[model samples]
Target: MSAANLYLERPALTPAAEDLREEVRTFIAEQRDSGALPPPERIGLGFDVDMTQRIADRGWIGLTWPRQYGGQERSALERYVMNEELLAASVPVGAHWVADRQSGPVLLKFGTEEQKRFYLPQIASGNCYFCIGMSEPESGSDLASLKTRADRVAGGWRINGRKIWTTNAHRVHYMIALARTSPAEGARHAGISQLIIDLKAPGVTVTPIISMAGEHDFNEVLLEDVLVPDEALIGTEGNGWNQVSAELAYERSGPERWLSSFRLISELVDVLGADTQPSTQEELGRLISHLLALRQLSLAVAGMIEQGKSPNIEASIVKDLGTKFEQEAVRVARNIASAEDLVGNGRAPRLRALLMHAQQYAPAFTIRGGTNEILRGIIARGIGLR
Candidate 1:
């Protein structure tokens, strides 16, 4: 409750984590040399099932999970280092990203022993995939205001509602949906529950919601009388609000938040060397400084999670500033391209394509996961300002 709670001590990575970073870099280099993982023309996490399997083959998928669950029992900081390298190079991790980052952790924390045994190994092996089913068409960032209801049925729960902005729902195998299990009562957060729904089951429909970047990564899923067994319920019947808050902490604090536009920035740096105008140098320096600061804050949150602490407020702060930095990076990249004339005459074609894609994707940076407005409110309330 004190302002001092906002202080985030920098995390010192273990030697093992640093070594893991080099190993990941070597893997990336090998993949690129084999022409399997080429530089992407577009941004965001690229999807490649083969690439995911290769990562799993190296025991990198669930790096920090228990060995019994097909993990290496490594440190969270090691996982952090591996992900930083993979994402920085824009590795095709889309296939297993959701399962590894959010769903696997959620299951580990709240699922029954049977559920963990059933899903964790598959996720760690990169054979299974998952997507988030939190946002509703009408609910925006007010998650407690969702209308998706899962009424108690004969064998289990019969779900009937729609979920929007579901990332990779079409390609993934399952979705952990947040639905109203019981009517809202004393508090709106009550009665909410998360249920793992089979995307291939009958009465489940997935429709694409393409982004301005002309990608089919987002989808809207309709659940019509979808019946799932009682075991599908994650955590407790009415404890979904708490579980989702924890899941969002994972979603909002990763390097993905600040590193989304990193490739574009890197491309800009390559196109504009040190001999550029002093004004340009200042702009580039400012952008890089913001990135380093965000990385430190993100590392602090990762360390807290490893220590069995819930740094939800700190996670929100990271996402809030990190996403804004992403948007700014896009603008900076575009401006630098225009000023340097790097995009003219088809010169620096890769940078041109990346800048174009980033511009289209930048607006959604603050919108996804949770809106900046909503995150700021969480930060204010956490600091006792509200």
Candidate 2:
């Protein structure tokens, strides 16, 4: 595809999908009223097991999969709308986010019927949680250069290596890890395979890495001769690169990409009035316009997914733009708050805490999933620039 075909055609949501929004909003309101979902002082997908179970009780997880696999068989656009409402309200969806977003879908696509039966239902029921195991200590975004290895052994594979910056590794039940099972043979992306690892295995150790925001959401996971049964291997052997690439699309092109700082933006809106300066209004207008455009592009990606097409390039575009917009949101919110004198006034304590948290968290915007440079490389290659 050339640069001319790079832009995704915007998708229109079906009436059914649009109607699902109110149901989600009602659930959020109920959670809030029950004290299950409190006003967040920070801006991110929070981890709450009870909240995840409540969402699962609503059949929100795995909404697009086949009913046999415990999904509602809904459209991807419907899932997108549901997530938009949930994130806009700062719902704590971190517990089941990864499994619902990618792991379950990947299993549906490449896993055996046995694997699907064992894993999909549990994920849908919010009984199982998963985390990504891609990054290594020094690999950065070059996943092909990972040093983790899973050697063939009797009845299983023995995995040995380290995964750094693994989000929720300490809390999640399992990790879908990428490891080299054969020689590269002059192809760096070859000889790789995906394996499911139990986080509580004997040889697996997870050590917390506290973020600058003082959160334990990140961790360093080590695997020393950790053996997983042969059935743990996902899809074909020596095919992990393609699998991980597809999984990255799921990770990159979600509402979470752009909406991490939305609470801060929404709070800023609450404090800003008609008497606000024209300059702030202009900045706020531009920010919102960009958000709307990003939403359209993200929806287009969801449309592609619904049609069973992989929009890797389009997803990278959305993530790149979305993450950048997130950082800009923090900067704009800070300026607006300073201008409005909303901080330290005791009138908007939640906004003040959110601002502080967003400032500490903003630096991670472009680095997670894939760095901006790596995403741009994917974009360039897709457009025939590389």
Candidate 3:
């Protein structure tokens, strides 16, 4: 049970990630000094359209997307590495994170040629954005119970329902909505379809909800008989549930789960200085160990995704543990410094900003993507707990 044993068993980063890692580091450093980068507040959660466009201009947004969509056509592992670098630096990636991570690939796999041509290039250019419309007033984790209905109208379908907890919906142009196409028949999970609805459609209405931090990143969107064209349907009818389940495998797994508090990590290390005490080292070591474990598990999931396999159960485990690890960083950050010191923290301006940000945002780490309870239930079912 030596450190070397744990280190040796650690999954090493592929060479592609290693090379891409340095390139990203250099890019961030240049952006930081040039004022091209937003403040640390904007790093992880800020809304900076120009910065997002700059990152997209660098061809770093959709690295794994097909070349036909203006992507670099890189490996998933490479994209993983790129994302790790971006998150570690706390870049303003909110604009392209969804498209690059989940929606674009899902479209490439199931979308019609017309859909691909319209959205992919725009996503690649950082001009198009999408919000997830899976959660409804009654249906949060229990997606099959969703009541959103889509009735077939002449040239398209009329969508009517309200989606709650819709993140960034007010700012985005489109949402990938999951609607019930037909009444439930044999099973609760049947007859649902995915539609790409324009947020600016005639009948669509968006209202912002301010969170504890006074941020309006969350919104509620009411679709009142919104008419979406026939081409807006993604994948196939009655297959939305399965498609979303597979897509969650990517959404739930990745460095973002573990590294959301990276700013706090950097702050802690700096505030404690390089000459921290033994107890501090022990606590830091524990967080580092958890991060390593999550990294390996996430890497394995990335590999499966690269090979076109859905590692759903494995992703649940990674996300569950990783979010817990992120919470730990927040918990200990408070204990490491006195209340006065925390507020007066000027040791490192950027890192202090990050720690303050973490303290306010840590609670959402588990709730936003999927609650810890929801993820564990899935894992238990996967392991035959039923």
Candidate 4:
């Protein structure tokens, strides 16, 4: 099917799924009230382990996985409600975000029974965390050109390469990395394999890469002669490219894509009183309309995933549009209020902090997960334009 002719039908959430939103909101409120979680403005792009554990105890981590895997066996719509609420509240979900969103599902799809038995429970329980090792210094957007190599050894594979911009690498216990298992034969995607590498291994080093905002969530991971057991291989050798593609669909098309700047909007509303100017109101309304539309698009993708269909093109669309919206939100908020006044005066400390953080973080919104240009190319290809 040509991408231009492709249509993603809108999917409605069940009443039961809609009800899950209130339950999630209540849980978040209780956590905030009990001081278990910081206010949205204070939260950076990192997760709190204790908070993740608390969420796991509620069985919200693996909401759609099997019962034996410590999941609630719920529908994707239900998971969507919970995830959207969490991101909207700016909860610190970074710790288990990768694991719950992608790693667990990947393992379920490709891991051996033993691998599933060992990792799924831990991930669901929030005792284990994971990072993605895809982009390297020389190969950021062009993942097919990654130079990380893993050679077959006696009982395992010895990996040697570096992965840059690895989010949560310093905090995660494991990384699901892609490496070259053999020489490139025809395509650059050939001979690539996915391995579950232990981050605590002898030759594995994670050096923090502070962002322009001075956040320490990203790292440069170096693997030198790091041995991963044969059992750690995910799916088959030479299939990493396909597997990672699937993983990126999950990574790119989520509530986080648009909701990353939600706090700015929330604060904007608070700062702009109910008696604000009509023009400002119109602008805010426009942002809300875009947010609503993008959200429905994202939910449709979630439904596709639940139906066992890969919505790669649709996901790319969401990430592209959603990221543009995020960047636009920052611009609107900046124009609406003076960040300097808010920071200097204690009247809007929370708004000031959120604005400061969002301003610095906005530039990367279009870069991470996938570059905007790359996503547009994928979209064009899907639509038969490329």
Candidate 3 vs. true structure, TM-score: 0.92
Ranking by lDDT: 1, 2, 4, 3
Candidate 1 overall Cα lDDT vs. reference? 0.91
TM-score of 4: 0.96
Scored by Cα lDDT, where does model 2 land?
Answer: 0.91
TM-score of each predicted structure versus truth: 0.98, 0.97, 0.92, 0.96
The per-prediction CA RMSD against the true structure, in angstroms, equals 1.3, 1.4, 3.6, 1.9
By TM-score rank, best first, the candidates go: 1, 2, 4, 3
lDDT per model, in order?
Answer: 0.91, 0.91, 0.81, 0.88
Among residues 3 or more apart in sequence or in different chains, the pairs in candidate 4 whose N, CA or C atoms overlap within 3 Å are: 3-382, 3-383, 4-383
Model 3 per-residue lDDT tens digits across residues 247-322: 7887899888888777777766656666766767778788888877788778777777777776787788888999
Candidate 2 on 30-138: residue-level lDDT in tens?
8888888777899779999988998999999999888999999999999999999999999989999999998999999899999999999999999999998989997
Report the C-alpha displacement of residue 211, candidate 4, in angstroms: 0.2
